[model samples]
Target: EDKLSQEEKQSRANHLMEVQEQISYDLNQEKIGKTFKVLIDKKEGGHFVGRTEFDSVEVDNEVLIDASKFYCRVGDFVQVKISEATEFDLYGEVV
Candidate 1:
C-alpha cells in the first residue's frame, strides 16, 4: 500500500474549497442585479457598510455602498440595487 504525500493532501483540500466556493456562488447568482432593502450600519474606511435581511446583524454577509452616492446615516433603511456578488459580500448602489 502507498501513503498519500503532504502535497497531495493539501492539493485535494484546495480543490475541495474551490468546488464549494463555486457552488455557493451559483446559489447566490440570483441575487445579482436585484434591489434589496438594507439597513445602514456604519461607515468603514470610505464606504458605508450595511447588510440585508438575508444577512445576520453581526456575523454574516455585508453590502458595500459608495459613500458619495447618497446621504445616509447609521440605522437608516435604504433601498439598494445589487450590482455584484462574491462568496461573502455584495456591492450595490443607492436605488
Candidate 2:
C-alpha cells in the first residue's frame, strides 16, 4: 500500500491545477489569428464588449472593440479577428 503526506497531496493537487491551466491556455491559444462573429452585450470606456457564438461551460468568449473606431449597440453582431487569448477572456479587432 502507498500513502501520501498532506504536503505531498497538496503539491500534487497544485501541479494538477497548473496542468489544467496550461491546457486551457493552449486550447485558447489555438483560437488566435482566427475570426468569429461576436454578439455585443456590454460597453465600457471606449470599448464595446461582446460574446461569441461559441460558449462552453458558461464561459463565453469576450470580444472588445474600440468605440472611437467602431459604432455598435447592444444586440448587434460584429465580425472580429482574434488578436489575443487568455485563460478566461479574449481580445480582438473589428474585421
Candidate 3:
C-alpha cells in the first residue's frame, strides 16, 4: 500500500471541500420558488441578511424585482420566497 504525500492529502482535502460546497449549492437550488420564514439577523450592503430553519442558509433580503414594497428590521420574521441562489447564499422577496 502506498501512502499519499502531505501535499497530495491537502490537495485531496481541498478538492473534497470544493465538491461538498458544490453539492450544498446544488441542494440549495431546490429552495428556489419556495417560501420560508426567515429571521433577520443583520443588514449588509443595504440589504437585510438572515437565515431560515432550513440548513441555516443565508437569505438575502434584497430582491432584484420590486424590492421597494417591503420593509423589515433586525429581529423580525418575514416570509420570503426564494428567488435566486448562489454558491452560498439565497436571495428572496417578502411575501
Indicate which candidate wins on TM-score.
Answer: 3
Task: After superposing candidate 3 on the true structure, give the runs of residues whose Cα lies further than 4 Å from its correct spot.
Answer: 56-69
**Residue pairs in candidate 3 whose N, alpha carbon or C atoms collide under 3 angstroms:** none
Worst lDDT 10-window in candidate 3: 58-67
Best by lDDT: 1
Q: Write the per-residue lDDT of candidate 3 for residues 1-95, one digit (tens) a residue.
A: 76999899999999998998888689778889999888777766657777885544433223222235567788888888988987777888888
- Models 1 onward score TM values of 0.74, 0.71, 0.79
Rank candidates by TM-score, best first.
Answer: 3, 1, 2
Q: lDDT (CA) for every model shown?
A: 0.86, 0.82, 0.73
Task: Show the lowest summed lDDT stretch of 10 residues, model 2.
Answer: 55-64
Q: Is candidate 2 or candidate 3 better by TM-score?
A: 3
lDDT of 2 by residue, 1-76 (tens): 5588889999999999899878878887998999989988878788898888886424655677778887888888
Q: Which of the two candidates, 1 or 3, achieves a greater lDDT against the reference? A: 1
Candidate 1 vs candidate 2: the TM-score winner is: 1
